[model samples]
Target: MPHLHGRVAAQESVFARMSRLAAQRGAVNLGQGFPGTAPPAFLLDAARGALGRFDQYAPPAGLPALRDALGADLGVDGADVTVTCGATEALHLLALALLGPGDEALMLEPVFDVYLPQVALAGATGVTVPLTLDAARGWQFNLGALAGAVTPRTRALLLNSPFNPTGTVFTEEELAGIVALARQHDLWIISDEVYDELYFGPRPTPLRILAPERTFTVGSAGKRLEATGWRVGWIAAPPGVTPGVLGLRQITSFSAPAPLQAAVAAALPVARDAGFYDGLRAGYAARMTRLASGLRDLGATVFEPRGTYFLTALHPHWTADSLLDAGVAVIPGEAFYARHAAPAGLTRWAFCKSDAEIELALTRLAARPELTDV
Candidate 1:
């Protein structure tokens, strides 16, 4: 019998496990980051129209028009963009292209769950630098820790802005510090900006804009369009890096679905003109506010998010399992950390859910006030 890959067989993803538990318990699931809403009508219409015209494999790099649209959105040349199955695949391809045995990648903690695994799969080590969580300031980047983590063997810095689980959008100062380190160390920068358009405050500056020579920007049309099922994503690399990404992509998923790529291409311009992004930001802001307020009312300390649809909260007495038992599901903050335990009692909740769903989870939580006393 053949042995399975060790990491692949070790454990199911916490997100998948929690979502499954939520289903089994018939609870309002706030564990995963997927949006509860559908993509806007115009985007759906474009997908339908595209499906009628494009049914074959797209060019491994992407449909030319989609690449062009992505380039326009990211302020990069079209030839530098390579479409991928999702930002997940883009990250994996990057690991394969830029890292190997004896190399290290700097990962900011709470890291996205995929970063460490992908680095391991590429035979590279992930060096994690934990961010500080201030009650008033939210998550703060530790420039000193990042600098200390860099080694001669370090190959890349993997970054996520409008960061997941914590929803901390990296500030320009932090980004600049990171860029400076990348420059000083001669390391590659893989910027995961899938949630770029979902910011609540000022938009985050792309790292590529600060250090184009060594940065690769990864984006997700699915996240921006509120259609995670589409799985349309791309990497906007510097000209020299694009070809390697495209080559790895050819053997990975080959290309994202042609119609989906076409649909995203068609929708990007219309979404921009119709203020779809503004509406998305406004809607998610309301949801986050509602959830945060409810958690506060229940004696939980909520970290107000500046962007993204998730927030981390501290309820010393409540665990994620306890929340699930109370009819709502969430992810434990520890799931995001690679090297350190999450601050005691922190858990991540997703407000990407519909208003009613958010309210129901809050109501369920309110009914179990004793859970917080335990």
Candidate 2:
């Protein structure tokens, strides 16, 4: 066999590995962040309607209708949007387009697992800035540490909010500090806002809104619509950067699935008019409360998430392996961090599951005397 690229050979997604283990062990699989429910009927209907007509390859940039719809929803110009296969691909495209050898990208610690590897793929150094967990404020990054990480080689800053693992939605003050740093350093901002609509509090302010000239914002139709397999996402960049990202898109996936793009276009207006986002927040808030309470009952310290359907808990007696054996699957907190050691006993649980699945996971944990025994 031909020798594989080092990056490809070295990469093993912990999510895929754990999901497989959970299946083999018959564990209630909270290890992956995918929703267990079907997408809404309106979205399915739109997909069906488009399947016959929009099946051909879309323009490399994307279907104009979908781009317009996304623009309207995101408050950006249609020309600024380039739809991609998913947010993962969008991030990869941005990294490749904006970074190169000897360049550096700053990433906050416990990043979405893809950020560091994508930076590496671009032949860029990824510098980690640790985010400390604050009991009252949730996860916070120090401006001083972030400033120290920037140098002449720094080209970009990658951020995820309603952040994965911790689920900390960046507040206005935090975002302002980050935006200030980006301006001072003349760095591009790649903000992953896949969970933008899934927030529980006042809607998150997109970084593009704060610093449009310097930010490339990533969003996911699949995440918002609960259709992860659809693989529909977009990058809303400033006009200056749009052409470069679209050029990269032509070489990458070329274009996202045309029918899926049309379906998302058709569904976006309906979702907005029907108050779907409000219901989504309410449902996830209830689920977060249920799961957080359940974990607390099991003697774990649950950090309540303000946005995103994930919760992190600290428990001296439980680890990912132990929980998997107890028939409840989770990802160890350490899997999310690139350089810093995660707090001892911290584990991330996906609450994207249904109430029934969450209860079953709780029951499985409660039944294991070894997990609760201090």
Candidate 3:
């Protein structure tokens, strides 16, 4: 057998593990983040109608129309947008452009799982600044830790607002501090804003809006339109940084699928699309409430979700694997953190499940009296 690279050969993702377990057990899965719904009817119609529209490869930077739509949506110019396979690809491209061996990237702990891997794939060291878990303050960003984490070797700051697992939205005041730190350290800001539109409280300000020159922002239609399988996303960078992204794109996947690009372009929300934003928020908010309420009734300490489809709750001693044995599957929160530590007793339940799926999960969980005894 041939040798394999350590980083590339790492074990299957926690998602893959939990999903396989779910299949084996036939458990009601809230373990993975896949949304249960499809995109709005208009978006689906656009895709279905695009069957024979454009058969050739999209431009390496993406379909020009899709780029333009993303530009307008992001308050940037079309020329500044580089569409990629998905937000994950966009972030990896940013890391490829920003970091290399000996460089250090700063990120929050319990990050979206891919952040660290992307940093590693860049051959960069990832330094984590944790968000403090405080009931009074909610999950608060620790600026002091961020300030302390910076060193001369720090090359980038990877940030995710409306964070996963915690669901804490980074406020303007917090961002102002981050901006100051970035300015002081001359670090590139690779902001993952995939869940930005899902905010339940105050809207989050994209880091690009605050520091366009130094920030590369990533967004995805997968989350925005609930069409993960379509894999349409864009990286909005300042004019100065886009050439590097384009260069990376040319050598990579070359371009996203054509029909999906056109479909996304057609259905993307513009300033006039009030109904799209309103309806999206209302639907997800209802799901979050239902899931959070259900978990609370089970004596779990549920953190009210501020954004995204995930609801984080504390389990006294339950592992997601054990939960699968109980016929319910949720992601064990420890999987999100980079460093090994005692499990935080947290489980992130994806409320993106359909109403029936959610009810089934709740019903199964409710019958497990061992859950509430904790």
Candidate 4:
């Protein structure tokens, strides 16, 4: 038997904790970030058909059709694609393949919870730079602070734009600043872009598009297609990362489900088009307005989002324990940060659910003021 490193040792994840409490209270859950509704009709229908076809193990990389469709969408080739169970698995494989004991990966504060754990479990230190939100810059952070955080040990930069919890879209200037640093230090970048198509304004640009030579972009069928349970995702990397990512993927996942891959292949082109993505943004925008306005009316601080399906609220007296007791389940802002303390007290609520679900949750929330109780 071997002893696990302290970084790799963990308790229950934030998702499990909030989900379990939500179940127990029968509360209207805005904690879990997945959609409460079914995927689009075409994707679901494709999934059903996929069940009847290739029931065996999928190809190690992915179904050729799915890879080809993704390549066409991303402007990459099939050979550079490495499909995995989900974006989560893809990140894990990349971490294992790239990081060593002394390596460091820099991720933003108020960051995604999934990144730190994966980086830590891979025997690498996960460093943090903070992104703060206020009335002025919205969710933007100081580029100087980020630049100062890097060191010689920093081997990579982990990015999740259209960021979760904050919903801040990294502007072209911000990306350029980060790219300059990476180019200076010769750092690899692994981006979490699962919400790439869920923008509320102008289309978001990907890091790979800017610096394909040193970038690996990971995305999934879950967010845009509303198929979280399907767990089909792909990593499109530059040729430099081709060998390690492809080989390590086989060891971790072996193969993602053939049927889900087929279904995602059918769904990719639909999700790739501008009209479909715009419709998605429209739907989420309506819900965002509904929830963010309600929170503001309730006298809670709300940072409205530019992209992604999350709504973040800040209040002094919020906590996971208190929110669960108040019958509206949400994840605390503290859950998202690993190194730096959250700039203020906050909570994140998922607005990806049905309209009725979002309404019901907000209504229940309005009846209770315990969320702001100090």
Candidate 5:
């Protein structure tokens, strides 16, 4: 067999492997960040309606109806949108369109693991600026370090608000700083707003308002609507970036799945359902509080999350020499970073589980000394 070129090890996904292991062991899945629920009922009915009626392929860009709805939500026009299979495809397509050899892509460390491999696959140098969490206060961005990481070779900066893994939410002011820096350097800004709807605090406004031309915002119905299986996500770019993204998307995926697109399109009008979203946010917030309080009760220091569906903690006492084991499974913080690797006792637990699941996991963690403090 011939060896394939451009195969980067960084492209390998550990989350999938971990998820498979969890399934095989019948372990709770805190490793993977997927919702465990169905989408809106109206959306499902809409998809059913579209089936057979619209079984054929959609336009290469996307369904005209969906694009229009998305445009209204994003405060952009239909001409500026291109729907992809999911935010994953949208991210990949954007990478293909925006990055090339010698161009450096800058992002925060302790970031999404996908960024490393995707950037490498794009034939671009990846520069990661670390976002260290302060225990005294909530996890915060190291702004000075972030600014210093930007340079002449930097082509794009990827920012994820309501960030995954750490759950650090970016403020409007922080986004303003990022926009200012991008403008100063003429860099493209790729903002992943997949978790924008999962916020526990005031929702961060879109950075698109600052520099619409330079910003590419990625949104997902999977995350917002609890329909991961539906796999409907879109990229909202300016008119200029849309052409490039459309060019890449055609060959990558001519169009999103028709039935799923229909479902997503139907769901868009009420994605931010006040009653549903408010309750959902409150539910996750309660889960977070429970998990954090439980960890503290067990004498572990917890890193509080302001947004997103995760809670991270530090087990400083459980070093390589003095290992303390929590019987429950979690993703190690190191999994999300490229440098200054997260140390032993540093673990991440997801709060997206139901109250019962959360209580069970906490009990399992607290009662089982055999699993920790080696």
Candidate 6:
């Protein structure tokens, strides 16, 4: 293991491990962030339409129609869009294209667990900077900490807006600070905006509008349409960055599923209707409110999620010291960070579940009130 690359070693399948645990224990799974339902009906039908027609491999840069649609949605030009298997492949491609041995990349602490391993695998050093959420103010990027962490060796900054785990979306001001940092350090900004459309309120415009050349956004059709298994995701970077992305795309999977790309192309025009995404935002907002209020009523502290379908609970008074076995399978907060990992008492939940499922999960949480005091 010592001789193996740091990236591959760091990259254990957290979701897979927890999924098996949930299956064995019959724990209510708030562990994974994907919806357990089939993708939107219209999107599914569109894929079926392409089965016999577009079933073959697509161009290495991705299908033009899908790429063009992705560009239109992100407000970038089509030349900047390149589709991949999922955000997983898109991120991997970006890391490979932009990073190399001895280079350094900065990441926010409590980020998606998959990222640290990917950065290490790319032969780059992973720098984890913490984002502190004060009970009164909410979660915020620690700019000073980020600034101090950057050096000439730092080549990129990877961030997910509408963040996972914490679900903290950046304000316009926060975006500016980060863009400034990128400009100051000449760092590539890898913006994971998979949850961009799942925001609670006020849809955020991608910062690529501000620094088009320096930012690469990873977008997901799966999260956009509750179609996690569809696995159609894309990378939208500046024209200058496309060649680097293409270079990696050449050796790797090369292209995405042609049928899924066609489906995504068909789904895009429908998915981008302002009213459609607004309805999505509102529904998730309602769910967040429901779960946050429920957890609070049970005397558990809830960290309200802003963008993604996730929220954190700080069981400040839990008696068991850990909550994994309490018929609820929320991930411990420590799994998200490399340093200052929470020892226990913090759990991450997925609100992407159906309303009924969320209610049932809440009931299970209420049933275990005694565990909070142990």
TM-score of each: 0.98, 0.98, 0.96, 0.95, 0.92, 0.93
Model 3 misplaced stretches (Cα beyond 4 Å): 270-274, 340-343
| TM-score of decoy 6 | 0.93
| Model 6 backbone overlap count | 5
For each candidate, the alpha-carbon lDDT, in order, equals: 0.89, 0.90, 0.84, 0.84, 0.77, 0.81
Residue-wise C-alpha lDDT for candidate 3, range 1-374, written one tens digit per residue:
98776666777888878878888989988988888776678888888888799667999998998988888888899998999999888988988989999999999877778888888898898988777776455566778889998999999999887777778788789899999999998889988888978889778888888888899888999988888888888889876778878999888789999999998898886423856876788888998899888888888887887888887887785778678878988888888887645246878898887988888988988888887677
Candidate 2 residue-wise lDDT, 266-371, digit = tens? 9999999999988888888888899999888888888887778899988999889999989989999989887999988989999988999999999989998888
The alpha-carbon deviation from the true structure for residue 168 of candidate 3, after best TM-score superposition, in angstroms, is: 1.2
- Candidate 1, residues 1-374, lDDT tens digits: the string is 99876677757899999999999999999999899988899998998999869899899999999989988878889999999999999999999999999999998899889899999999999999999988777788788999998889999999888788678787788888899999999999999989999888888888889999999998898889989888998899987778767778889988889999999999998999899999999999888899999898888888987777788998878889889899999999889987988899899998999999999998888887586553
| Best prediction by lDDT | 2
Q: Alpha-carbon error at 248 in model 5, in Å?
A: 0.8
Model 2 accuracy (lDDT, Cα): 0.90
Clashes (backbone N, CA, C under 3 Å), per candidate, total 0, 0, 0, 0, 6, 5
Q: Per-residue CA lDDT of candidate 6, range 13-32, in tens?
A: 66766767777887777778
Where does candidate 1 clash, by residue pair? none
Model 6: CA > 4 A from native: 1-12, 317-324, 372-374
**How does model 5 score by TM-score?**
0.92
TM-score of candidate 3 relative to the true fold: 0.96
Model 2 collision count: 0
Report the C-alpha lDDT of model 5 over 240-297, residue by residue, as the tens digit: 6688778788898798898778777777786555466787788778888987898787
